[model samples]
Target: MRIAFYGSSLVSAYWNGAATYYRGLLRALADRGYAITFYEPDVYDRQKHRDIDPPDWCKVVVYEGTVEALKRVAAEAAKADIVVKASGVGFADDLLLQETMASAGPSTMKIFWDVDAPATLAELKAAPEHPLRRMLPSLDLVLTYGGGDPVVEDYRAIGARQCVPVYNAVDPQTHHPVPADPRFAADLAFLGNRLPDREARVEAFFVEPARRLWRRRFLLGGAGWHDKPLPPNVGYIGHVPTADHNAFNTTPSAVLNISRDSMAENGFSPATRVFEAAGAGACLITDAWEGIELFLTPGEEVLLARDGQDVVDLLAGLTPENASVIGERALRRVLAEHTYAHRASEVDRLFRNHARRVEAAE
Candidate 1:
């Protein structure tokens, strides 16, 4: 089967958090005998900051951000067995969604893959006239990055034909354990860009903890935080590239995962970094959220924190030996059940079942 995925950049992770998720899921699908063509717009300086060249597993088409270019790509995409319009392309999104849906043939399954289901659901709830809400009944399937049953139920309530959550998983080949680097050494480290929805939580889970524990080292990476005030103990390294993520994860005594407000509130939405850090054998401390244990065991494989005080307390009592034990356990768990290969198998099953049902109906 062939898939045409229209999403954020595949070659760049600059400001695009979905890059790794797309790569892992699609590469695994390719390995399972699916042909994929990723269509990404050449905007947001993504082309300038390309992380990886177009890989052999999938063809990537970087088109100019114009109506003519979009129309051409949409026409080409109509040939695929599946057409996916992922949320948050960050450029001409409404136009792209319209073109994708309008051009999809009857035989091609139309998918609205929501990388941020919580935010999208809120939008649909607030604005019933939203384009995606109107298109739900026509869509063959609604696949979410992650939101568990709540997301599926909400989509069903909004008249979606079908809804499924394809949670994020690590590509072990791309994010396995690496030798620790001194540059990323810290008692606790966090890697996330500064954004409105995420900033307050970052302050609660990361910044305030650093302030409370002035003696401990706290390293922060990701773009858009150069000017943000931080405790003297917290070091900021802006925009660590994808290549350095393994090192960043491995070197820290413990890595922190802070979800955006929407994701945390919605629960079951583990950010891609959660698996990436675990894949690199980093002891991870995540904020309290629903359905965390479904991914990683809280006390054994992962650590849970309710707020900055919990983070500070966890760091204060954590030892190198215990951190290593937790990290190793988390790594083993993810490798066994949460790798991209595992996810791809689930996706393959879903597609096959859906196809059989469609054929029977016909």
Candidate 2:
């Protein structure tokens, strides 16, 4: 199978958090002997600060995000077995969507891979006449990063012929347990790109906890958080690179996972951080959400906090032995059930089944 995927960035996590997901899943697909070509726009300063060098198995084609460029890639898009336009493709999403649809023949699987299903599904509900609604039925499939039952029902309700959740999973190879780095050693740590959807949650779950734990050290990593008013005990380390994710997760006493409002409301959705942190055997404490039990068993495998006070109390009360035990449990759970290899196999099976079904129908 030849898959042409258009996503935020494959080579650089930079400002694109989906880079890890892309790398893990695509590399797994390549391991299955599928030919994969990832198309990424050369914008958003990602091209300026290139992170990972060229990948070995797949061909990554970076193009200027212009109509002319889209036109040039139409033939290649048409030739592939699947052409996917991921949710947060930044600029030229609409342009690329239309051109990809135009180029894809009946044999090609025109897919919309929604990395942010909660946000996308919310918009579809809020806006009855969303352009995506008109396009959903025309596509071969819709894939999501998170969003359990509600996400699937809503997408189908909104005219999506097929809506599937491909929940975020761990790439054990890149995110397994590692020796701690003293520089990142902290009582608590949170790493996320600062966006409006998540800043308030950060303030409530992360920043406020820092305020209460005056004696304990906290570490903050990610871009756009340099100017936030944080507590004296909190140390903000701007933008920890993808290569250093294991060190960052392993170094902290307990790493924090805060979901955006849309995701929390939707339920059953875990962020990339959840798997990454747990993959490193880091003790995890996340804000309260409805469907988290599907991933981690709270109060046992993972810890839960309802608000600022809950986080503070947990941090203040936790012992090193208890934290280590919790981290180990979560790690075991993730490795057994959630891995990129598992997700990649699912994709392969789904596409194969779809192809076989089509052939039989004829």
Candidate 3:
């Protein structure tokens, strides 16, 4: 099948967190013999910070951020067997959502893939006249980046025909153990762009822990936070590129994963970094969330923390030998159960099955 997917930049991870998720899922889908075209806007300085050239697996259309350009792309996108508008496209998203759905043929599958379901859901609830809320009933299906049954139930409550959670998974080929780089050496490290919803959590889970443990090294990477004050022990590296992620992940004795407010409250939503760190065989410490055990076992494959104190406690007792053992165990679990190939198979099955159902109805 031919698929046209509209999302934030696929070639840039600069300020876009979903870049790896898009690459992994789409590349795997292409491997399964699907013709995929990804449409991304040339906004957010992402175009200048291109991480990878357009891959052979998918055709990427970098369009101007204007109504005329969007209309043209929407027309082209409507010709595909499936047309998708992923949440957080970062520019003219409401118009693109409407245009993509309106332009698609009757037989074409219309999907709204939400990369951040919790935040999206909250927005929909706050404004009944939201564009997606109005369009939900018309969509063929809703696919989520992560949010187990709760997200499915909520989307269904709002009028989705079908809602499925395609949680984040690691692309073993893209992320794996490599020689640790000295520049990233730290007892614990975190990589995420600073945002309002996440900054407080980062302070609670990452900064506070660093403040408590002055002797241990803590490295922070991602956009923003250049001026944000940090404890003397915590080192800030602004915006590590995708190419250096493997080194960043492997070098840290343990890496941290902190979710935004909505995701933490809703639970079951694992940030893409969780899988990326695990893929690189890094011992990971994640803030407590529901459905974590479904992905990695607590205290065995991963370390779970409820607050800054929990993070500090986990780090204090962590030995290099034990961290290595935990990292190895997490690596084995993810390789066996949570690879992009595995996720792509699930997505492929859903696409085929949905097609069959639509045909039968006709």
Candidate 4:
């Protein structure tokens, strides 16, 4: 099987949170004998802050920002068994989306993979005149990275032939626990970019807790958070590399998971960080969400924080033995059921089912 992704940037995690998910999923697909190609335009200064070099598992093609480039790639897109257009390509002009969708041949399947399900749905609902609205019905399938049942139903209502949720999962080999370094070790740590919508949640969950636990060391890492005021006890380390993510997760006594506003409102959506933290055997302190229990059993495998005070209490109350128990349980659960390899198998099944349906129609 040949799979291709038209996304923001495959090799850079600069301002993109989907890089880890893409790398893990595509690499797993390659391991399963699928040929993969990721098409990314030279936009967003991604070249300036390239993180991981292109791996041998998949071909990474960089296209220039021109009509000629799109024309040149149209044939390649038509040749793929599956071609996916992710929500935010960073440079996908109206013309580009139309051109790419039109280029798909009868044999090639096209999918609109929504990485930001909540935000995309909100935008489309709020603005009926959105460019992608009309394109929804033409795509063969719609896949979302997060957002559970409600998201899938809504997409179908909006005219998607088939809609599915492929939630984020961990890559066990890359995310397992490692020896912690003193520099990164902290009572609590959070790694996420600062966005306007998530500011209040960040303050409520991370900043407030740090303020209450004045004596405990707290670490905050990610881009666009440099100017955000923080409690004196909280350490701000901007933008940790993906390679060092496991070390960062392992170093923390407990890692914090804060959902974005849209995701929190949608319910049941867990980001890549949740699985990554668990994969690293780090005690996870996450804000309460409706569907969290489906992924990790609260109190048994993961700890839930309702607010800043809840976080403060957990930090003060948890013993080393209890934390270790929770971390180990979470790690075991993730390894058994939530690895990228498992997700790849799920994708393969979905593709096979689609193929069978197509054959029946023929």
**Most accurate candidate by lDDT:** 3
lDDT of 3 at 191: 96
Report the lDDT tens digits of candidate 2 across residue range 1-362. 89988888898998998998888889988999899998888888898767788798789998887778766775578889888989888867777777777888787878899998988877778888777778998988999988888899989988989888888889998898999899899999999999999999999999877877788899999999988888888898898888899999988889999998999888888989999999999999999999889899998889999999999989988999999999999999999989999999998888898888878887
Model 4, position 182, has a per-residue lDDT of 76
Model 3 misplaced regions, further than 4 Å: none
What does candidate 1's lDDT look like per residue over 187-240, in tens digits?
999999889999999999999989888999999999899999999999999988
Question: How much does candidate 4 score in TM-score?
Answer: 0.96
**lDDT score of model 4?**
0.87
lDDT of each: 0.93, 0.88, 0.94, 0.87
Candidate 3 residue 12 Cα shift, in angstroms, is: 0.3
What is residue 350's positional error in candidate 3, in angstroms? 1.0
Higher-lDDT candidate of 3 and 4? 3
Give the TM-score of each candidate: 0.98, 0.97, 0.99, 0.96
Name the better of 1 and 3 by lDDT.
3
Report the C-alpha lDDT of model 3 over 202-314, residue by residue, as the tens digit. 99999998998999999999999998999999999999999999999999999999999999999999999999999999999999999999999999999999999999999
Model 3 misses residue 39 by how many Å? 0.5
Model 1 poorest 10 in a row by lDDT? 101-110
Pairs that collide, model 2: none
Model 2 steric clash total: 0
Instruction: Look at candidate 1 and give me any clashing residue pairs.
Output: none
Worst 10 residues of 4 by lDDT: 91-100
